[model samples]
Target: MSTLNSSFGSRFGLEYLPTSFMVRMGKREMMVCRDFRKRFYAVNPIMECDTGVQAGHLEVLLFRRWLLILSKSKAH
Candidate 1:
């Protein structure tokens, strides 16, 4: 499979995964990094989409080192 380049949409997706230093979207979760010129990074898991095969791109963004995951929905 081809790797995805930086894009606005994919960058937004990374927001879902908190505490992620680098993220790359793909058929399956793969290793991704901002660049080979940085230090002090955190590793996060990448979630796989349940959609069918289609053209897609991965966007890598730099998140906070102490990022926290917020609750998706409030408990009733």
Candidate 2:
């Protein structure tokens, strides 16, 4: 997908979601802190749109970490 075409349209039901590339990036910025080397200094837990047919070690780690993040959705 083009970075320029970065947002979800209202036609897509997921428009309510903040998962567009830019939005994810914004959230990542709000939560993640970096050091001089741009390594993780502090960060609130967040998940990524991981893609693979089979789970790798890192995928398992992400899965476990994602489980720690609680979802408190009020939308029904």
Candidate 3:
């Protein structure tokens, strides 16, 4: 998993991006991508976990926004 994170970080030049990526264990395998928008379209639903139970949904949303801000800053 660290290897995957490192590779992605290197590719995007965002060292903290991979930190937002997560794997959750529940009834099935789930993953949260570093980029929130990509997760909705490109990522499989099976790789998503229900965060409502732990109130983590808000954190995820905030982190996604942060990533977007970081990307935009880098773009300019």
Residues 1-76, candidate 1, lDDT per residue (tens digit)?
A: 9544433234234545543453333423332433222335453444322221123433233342232222112112
Across 16-73, the per-residue lDDT of candidate 3 in tens digits comes to 5455543423322232334433443433333332233222222223333432111111
- TM-score each candidate: 0.18, 0.16, 0.19
lDDT for 25 (candidate 3): 33
Sort all candidates by lDDT, best to worst.
1, 3, 2
Q: Which stretches of candidate 1 lie over 4 Å from their true place?
A: 1-27, 36-55, 64-76
Better of 1 and 3 by lDDT: 1
| Model 2: CA > 4 A from native | 1-3, 7-14, 19-61, 64-76
lDDT of 3 at 18: 56
Candidate 3 stretches with Cα past 4 Å from truth are 1-26, 36-59, 65-76
Residue range with the least summed lDDT across 10 consecutive positions in model 3: 67-76
Angstrom error of the Cα, residue 14, model 3: value is 17
